[model samples]
Target: MDNLTYGIIGCGMMGQEHLRNIALIKGARVAAIYEPDAGMRAASANACAALGLGEPRKAGSITELLSVSAVNVLLIASPNYLHLEQLEEIARIRPLPILVEKPLFTDPADAPRLAALRAAYPAPIWVAMEYRYMPPVTRLIEEAEAATGGVKMLTIREHRFPFLEKVGDWNRFNRNSGGTLVEKCCHFFDLMRHILQSDPVRVMASGGQANNHLDEAYGGEVPDIWDNAYVIIDFASGARAMLELCMFAEGARYQEEISAVGPKGKIECLVPGPGRFWPAHLGEPPVPQVIVSPRDPKGPVMVEIPVDPQLLAAGDHNGSTYYQHARFAKAAMGAAPIEVALSDGWWACVMGMAAQQSAATGQAVRIADLPCAAGLL
Candidate 1:
């Protein structure tokens, strides 16, 4: 594995973002891409050219992309519903090192299928949870315990723009995206588990499509994707976590504000949304920040966590995609261990599903009772 040649499936907006970040790596290049949409294919080609990387061979299908001899690794950035079947196809055709996007599977019924894939897949499969690598969030995770003296409560609040239009607008429907909790809020759930260092025992949530996409109808059907939610989770370690998400509040200065508190004090991180969306009049977007307040001091100390300009230009995730790709590349080459494994991805997805279920039924959902929790527990 002298160099990594990527075979990319679905070169849409997210896939193109991956390409930009991959260009930043020394030994990684996309060898081939499988994008069904002609417009997206053209856009991806233009993106590669703009990045000064040689144009990747356009692949008509996933099989064609996988068959490319130079393609030693894989990436799946397709729609949520297609993820499981695509992974199954990859496993059957060629089990190459893969980095798949989050919310591993959309349907709860597919959990058994995912479990089977997890059991038999013969290569490293890194789930893309880029939020974990965000500079501010990473800082919070690293210093939470020391700052808070063992975190007893954690809160993550995300107030940002609604879902961007994707190819075919597949994101507008719950059936396709596994509901707002699973599709968009999975990152927060994963963060809750990761930051607490414990699995969730139960989930309670109240969310609905209060705004955005309410009047928009595609093929005579209104969009059912939710725009806001509040989820409370009880962890196995006796810690409690809450998530507050509002997709219509894009005017806020910060997109994500996370805080953890304990008997000693509190620690919080403020992360801005994508710099591209920041109004030009506001000058540069707000720099990521971590604030620590110890009980003894009673004063808060805030530090700015700035990401590299080049990395920031590469993706909307505050340079997390680049960092995640760098680590995934190493894990693929056996130089590093997989930080976000199949189990981790499963737990994240399961938590989101449970949250949605709790919201829908107006009752708390027990994580242990979910069918997907069979082997995960």
Candidate 2:
């Protein structure tokens, strides 16, 4: 197909961000959208028109959207629980490329079926791990790959605002989101694997649902999602990754702080959230300076990761959504390979599930012991 027409499955925050980014990509457009919420559907159409992309046809149901002849590609950005079912539905219509959001599945129960589906599917299925396309994070990964002793240890920390309220409050339960680690921290896990270039062996974690949404009752049910977690992962190459996530800690200097340490040097990046004013006098506003420090503390160096001024101002992971779409478009057009593969997405979910299980049982969980780990491996 010379021109690609995308049908977005969900019109939520991520879905709308996709619409905004797709407008910036040439030869691609959101031809249709499937959002059940009437308000959100109308809002999505308005957003498209506002961006001069013209109003996208709003499909009244999933079946209607999938049947649209104008849509050549499908972008699945729906809630966690609906992903598997939607994937199954999309599979019936074969040869159409799909791009699914992170945390491949809410649970590992469907791993076997998904593996089978992948083996038989005709078109490419890519998962959206936007962090891999982030400029600073990419630079850090490149430097780590070039390090002398390889990557020894890595840490991904995010202390930011609480989870946003979804359309149905589905994010308040573990069954829906696969806990906070799977829902929100999968991106970090995928990044860890990409930087270290290894698979995880074991996971140990400690966390619980406290001080966030547990006290509130919506529809007479208390929230059961964890508000904080500290996870440690051991990879096969003796490299380790530590993730410290706190959902309630507000007003952080940076939304995400990532650092990778190797034998030769360490690379660290701090990305400020949108609208965060670090300093007016600073030459560059949002693009943070990367710090590279060698084993000897006396010698230190700094690097700048350039980002488009307009993209940095846009929402969704510091303009990563746009770059991700660019890459996806290229891959779909047979110009480049799929940057984030389905196996990597599944491994990320396995790591998250193991962490959640370990936190619940107060014991370390091995990745090889997880459900369907054999099939996945």
Candidate 3:
């Protein structure tokens, strides 16, 4: 397909963002959009109008959207719970290029289904793990070889808005969305895995509904998902990772840190976003803090790396993820290599699932038994 036709499911904030970005990607065009909400659908259509991408249609329900004649690429951005239904249908449409939003499946048990879908579809099915393609994160990973001797440990802290209150979607349900740990923290989990260059052998987690509930004043059932969680992961490479996730904070810090204790030295860098909370994902921020030190210091020698404002171009609102999808569109048109395949999304889901299992059982969930372990176990 020369000019790939794209169809988007769901018209929530994320779906609208996909539509907005479809233009930014050269080889693809938004063909149809599916949203059950009338007002939201109209809004997305209006937004697409500005780009003259044309009105998005409901495509006569999910079945037609998958089997439709005009659509080539399908972007599923619907609720966390409904992903499987659409994915299953798409699976029947074998070998079609599909771009699914993050957290491939809410449940690890669904990994088999995902495999079946991919086997059935077998085309370049991709998951939008956008952070992998972001200039800052990408550059940091690129330098991993030159910057480290051996990774000993990594840590990620995500203090985000209370998703239940902010997004108000089915993601609020643990069962529906694979809980916050997997559904939301998939990016961080994958990042941790990427940095360590290893798979988690064990995960220990503890969490409960620390916050994010409809107040008694409002009198409603709150989404029964954890607002705060601490997950500890031990990788096969002898590297351990500690992940902290809290959704109830007044200010959110998307702070990400990677520290590796290698033979030569320890490489540590902190991406300098709002350590407290900043909604600013758009503009250029100062380079994250980086420090390299000898593995065994003589006395107290120090190296303070200078600030780098040009470490990466400006980024915003997971829009860094937008470029990932852009590349997917390009790959659809045979322009660029697809970086994130379906298995990548599955690995993230498996990581999240292990965390969820660890959280529920109050034990160290082993990743050895995952169906899609790639024989790492």
Candidate 4:
């Protein structure tokens, strides 16, 4: 069809990022935005004008945005706590293609409700898990899948700056973000599941809020979000994954690193970020590379990292966001399939919740025991 118009909810950091990337997407334009904060609405409108995408209509509320008949899709980038509610509202209004940011719901308790809602509404909902689109990470998935014995072990590490300041500083609180794992590590969890091709069966984790946003109070409310966390997950297929996340590591060069080992060989990747927007690359940017040695030992054959030179210069998490928006536009127009499905998003959130539970109680949480495990398996 013609260019699809998307109405955005939130208009914060991620929303603005989508707006910028949508400019690069030929078949999509942000037609309306519903941000409660007037300043954010103005800023988003200014961005639209600056990008030459035309001024988007300012929507006062979700209801108003839904009322806009011109908008063909809804892009929900709101705070974590508002995800399910907004989704339910959108489903109630009409069946529109939706692109919701990762960690679909803040709390695991909402999982059953979400499932029930989906059964009733059955709208085409796609989750935004951009890590799957990253060039190096995508290569890792390819090598792992092609390996002789499959990926046996996976490791993800993120040492980067503290939580970015969000609108109203909502991200600083666990009550709003659903803990550090759900807020931040969902991307990694999603990636692990995608590469391993298995649903997580159990999880154990440990983390604490020490040196980050909690040091000070915002309007008398202390931030409860943890600054560091380590999570171990056992998948149903016997593949295992471990995550090490530290938000307090200042000046660390590679903000994120990932390694995977299979029965045949291994793959490693480092992502230079948290400062990527400046130079788009700091020093020598880590490229996605792989070394594969079969059981007979081909003597460690190295695989070249796949990168689009155009995307490498476009910034935004190695242009994953740009590709994601382009894919979203195509999917909305029925020209392509949704790469990140709703079930994938749900499982990632469920795993994050399981990790949060295990960390809190110092006990291993079985994925089967979680409330959200009903229909997902």
Candidate 5:
């Protein structure tokens, strides 16, 4: 664990981002990769070369990648549906510390499989909740208690562009990407719990495909992923949290705006979308900000939280991916504890699934009542 070497399962858009960030870390290097697509493999090589890192060996399969002696750590950035199976495959063959992307499992029936994996997996498995590490979001989480004097309510709003086309258009369908809520909003759900310091008891939502991807047909079927949603979650601590999501509002200055309020005051953080998407004509993108409003002061103070330009250039999520990988490397090297654990990932997905169910049935969904969550509960 002195020098971290990564074995990548997928090398698509997100995987390439991970590669760039991995190159930023001092002791981390990608030794082997198992990307099925030839174009992505070439792109990953080019990215590594641009970053001045040695070329990573290309493996045909996950098993082959795991067999490499230099690969002591694993990164699973594959398709949403393939995550669970690939984890299981790794566990069966050779278990290594893993940093897996969000929306851990797609189908409800797979909960038992996850439970089994949780029981058997020996190495650290950190779920990639990159938003939690964003500079503004991190500042908000750190200062929420003192600013709010015990938060009574929390709200997270995300207004951004539609999902980009993935390899083979897999992201356009619900089945492949675990629906919009679980696929896209799990990060918000995880944030709700992290900010509230409590688990959700009930979820009520109303969302549908109002805009974007309505007419596009793939394999003779239109995409069913939702583009907008309003979700209200009742936490076990009696605190209420809300999430507002719109996938067609890329024109908005900030992609994510989070607010927490209590009897004392309110604190809010504004995070812009990826800098690469910002129009060059606009001069420069908006910097991340955290505003604190004190009830007694009668004034609000806003602080600009600028990210490292190199980190921003590495990946999206406001340089959070790099921070997350830095911490994940520490956890993998036994220097620090896993911040986002398996249970955290499970709760995040469960909350999203509950929201999706509520929206579909037009009824509030209780977390305790979901059979899929029975194992976790």
Candidate 6:
């Protein structure tokens, strides 16, 4: 196939990001977008123009976008709660792949229904967990592989930006956003599963809503979701992880500066995200810094990994999303195996749900009980 045409649904902030990022994808192009809301529809047009792309041919509904022959893929960039309705439609549409946003569903209760709906689809559906595509993060995986002791532990104080406050939406609420554990931290859980190469056996978490009290003062409903959470993930490999969450990072929204203590060495990923994006804004940047500080029996040594030079410039956030899109297109073309397949997404959701269930029920949820795909995505 010359190009994998994608039909995007839900034209929101992330949708606009998709509009621009898809331009860089060599194997695939966003063929159309469907919003259904007049406000978002107009916004989508403005976004297309900003990207120097022509007006998006609007679809009256999700069904219409799937009907477009050139649009061989469905990108469900819609809000968290609005996913199930679209995924059900895409499953019957054709051989198209559906790329869903994170958290999978609005509530854990919908997991089985979504899976049953997906079971009927003759096509593949994947969740858009793009974090694993981060070039430096990928390098972290390589570094873990090269080490004889393997990754024994990691600690990251992940600070997030106030996007919900700026953008204004459901991410501010606990229910519609599927609570904090599933909504924001699902990506990290998936990334952990990808890097550790081991499924978490148990998750115990604790937190309560605190930061969004202004909602009540503004006459907005108080969200029940927790603003901060401390989670402990016990992986099958005996490598346990502790996650620190505070959505409002002091200087940046995200900062790992992770310190992984392995038997042979102590590897730290202190890569700053803002500095990475600043270079993209200024059009001056180099390869990502994936430094490994190894304290081997031979003494201390630092190693910096080198990835494909072209990837270094494209801003890892957008680049990783674009890379995953390209990879999906390649998988669709039968040129490569799907890295983040439907099963992968479902498993990620199961993991997140397990954590959520554990958090809500105040018990340790076991990964073994979560459903796994008996077949393909």
CA RMSD, predictions in order:
0.9, 2.2, 4.4, 2.3, 0.8, 3.9
Which candidate order results from sorting by TM-score in descending order?
Answer: 5, 1, 2, 4, 6, 3
Better of 3 and 6 by TM-score: 6
Candidate 5 lDDT, 3-98, residue by residue in tens: 798888889999999998999889777788898899998899788768766678899888889999989999999999999999999999999999
Q: Model-by-model lDDT, in order?
A: 0.93, 0.82, 0.68, 0.82, 0.93, 0.67
Q: Between prediction 1 and prediction 6, which has the larger lDDT?
A: 1
Summarize candidate 4's per-residue lDDT along 138-240 as a digit string, tens digits.
7667767565467899999999888888899999888899888998999999998898888899999999887897577898988889999999999988889
Clashing pairs in 3: 95-121, 281-315, 281-316
Q: Per-residue CA lDDT of candidate 3, range 176-200, in tens?
A: 7888788888888888777787877
Cα lDDT of model 1 by residue, 34-151, tens digit: 9999999999988887876667899988888888898899999999999989999999998999999988999988999999999999999999999999998999999999999999
Question: Model 3, poorest ten-residue lDDT window?
Answer: 306-315
TM-score of 2: 0.95
Q: Count the backbone clashes (under 3 Å) in each candidate.
A: 0, 0, 3, 0, 0, 1
Residue 154 in model 4: lDDT: 90
Off by over 4 Å in 4: 275-315
Over all chains combined, what TM-score does candidate 1 have?
0.98
Q: In model 5, where do residues sit more than 4 Å from their true spots? A: none
Where in model 2 is the C-alpha error above 4 Å?
Answer: 276-286
Model 6, stretches more than 4 Å misplaced?
50-53, 165-168, 216-220, 252-254, 274-288, 297-318, 368-377
